[model samples]
Target: MTLPTSYRAYKSNADGYQNLQLTQVDLREPKPLEAVVRVHAVSLQFRDLLVAKGDYGLPTGAGIVPCSDMAGTIVALGEDARRFFSVGERVCANFAPDFLAGEPTPENRAALGGERDGVLAEYVVVPAYSLVRVPEHLSFVEGATLPCAALTAWNALTGSTPIKGGDTVLVLGTGGVSIFALQFAAASGATVILTSSSDAKLALGRKLGAHYTINYKTTPEWDEEVKKITNGRGVDHVVEVGGLGTIERSVNAVRLAGSVHLIGTVSKGASGIPLIPAILRSIKLNGVVVGSVRQFEDMNRFIEARGLRPVVDRTFPFERAREAYKYQDAQGFVGKVVIEVVEE
Candidate 1:
């Protein structure tokens, strides 16, 4: 295989995440077990924002492409990679690179966009085992958002959550993961109670099948509202993104034997958990770190068969990748933010 220098959008330095430029990069010839992707689109996650700030502790150089979620068509294959993912197939690169079909391993845990290079570049070489076929009906923009937020949502929801149809779920905020969880829970026939700081966002959550919405900014004691919404029974599960500021309240909002999917925090560090409430309720708290390849495939199948659409708050041209991160930071969009790499 011949190596060609490809143009990629990269931040000049870790602190320059908001400032990026296109530069020519030579892609290494794929190993027999690798696939090289011609990236079509990438999505912005909080981790990408952190990478710009030098927070993710990833391997980086000046002008690194910073992102985790990407969807693209395969263009190159290693000598022995043909049996895995075929060239020309649309797929999303997996975060858990080495996890095959079931349980995770230490190596599978390294993940792209972290210890190794990630999907921010226009062309990325990934272990062929890590590719999950994107749903045929999903747009590139929507599919790009799934590798991170959607998979994390699916992992957190299915990890230990016992909620079934008729069970109520409490989702905090209207960010990417929460919104995906809200939509997915609804798809499973579970009722969802969505809370947001914005009334407009709350209305939009309702439009996405949330049975109820709470303005946590105005209604600070939203757990009480949760009780009211569930007719005093409390919710069956809470997708705990509110972190230190809201975890205890999240515990307060769940019924006995309920589960909490501890996902994210816009907070500085760990969230405060009220151990007494947790002890009394016996609420199960599970940590979610995206998902394995099998989980992603299952999610794609469900989304495609049900005609589910992953929300795209906005898109930025690949050339404007830096500006896209800045815009995503400034705007608390109801869903995912993306960048389209028009050329590979």
Candidate 2:
């Protein structure tokens, strides 16, 4: 395949996320250990929205490409890349390229869509080791949702305390991470209890294998409902994405020594959890920031072996990327919001 000399990219400026603009620039060839991918699709996450709004804490000087999760066919590969990956394989970039297997370090925390150039473009060059092969059964759109959201959910379930069969898991909300958590936990032979304000979405969760669902809007003390569903033993795991506003309840909802995987701050600031219950219950509050490249590979193997399909609520064309962000911000999505960068 002949590589284009230049390509179009979306850049977010100081003006705001809504002020994103498309610009054409020269596409550089990859280094010896790198690969150039022609992006097919990219998925939006809450962090992407934060970066676009210039509120992600990472520096976004001048402008920055604004999405981390992408799936594409590798168009070009350098000499060393041939050892691990091929020129035509479908793959996704790891969000944190530097952290491949172990505990994350400050250096490894530099992420796509923030400190580095992202894949909201025609092509993206990343380290050869940063690429994870997509499952054979998944479409590019489904593969695109795996890097951040799916992997975060994977890490949450299997990170600190691996979820066991028959254990009860609680996922908050029907967003990408929570939905993935629900699917993964259920597939692992666990009973999943998911909470969403919308009964419609909760019904969707049941279809996705959730054993029980709670309408948090109606059940303000939804944690009590969770406990009731679990026969007062509390759930064995909680995928806590609601941050401060629901952390207290998440603590109350988990069983003794159960794990609470803290994955997001969707609730902004809603006060802190009392450590006394956490201390007394010996609950594990595991903070998950996506996962390592090694974990991505592990997840892909599991996904492919099990034929797990990512739930993508809607897709938009590349030109409507800003609309995709706004739609995600509107928070009506049942799963993931993806932007199709190229046709299948």
User: What is the C-alpha local distance difference test score of each model?
Assistant: 0.83, 0.92
TM-score of each: 0.93, 0.98
What TM-score number comes out for model 1?
0.93
Model 2 stretches with alpha carbons more than 4 Å out:
none
Give the per-residue Cα lDDT of candidate 1 at 118.
Answer: 69
lDDT per residue (tens digit) for residues 112-203 in model 2? 98888788998998999999999999999999999999999999998889999999999999999999999899999999999999999999
In model 1, where do residues sit more than 4 Å from their true spots?
A: 1-3, 57-64, 267-271
Give the distance in Å from residue 47's predicted Cα in candidate 2 to where it truly belongs: 0.5
Candidate 2 at residue 286, lDDT?
93
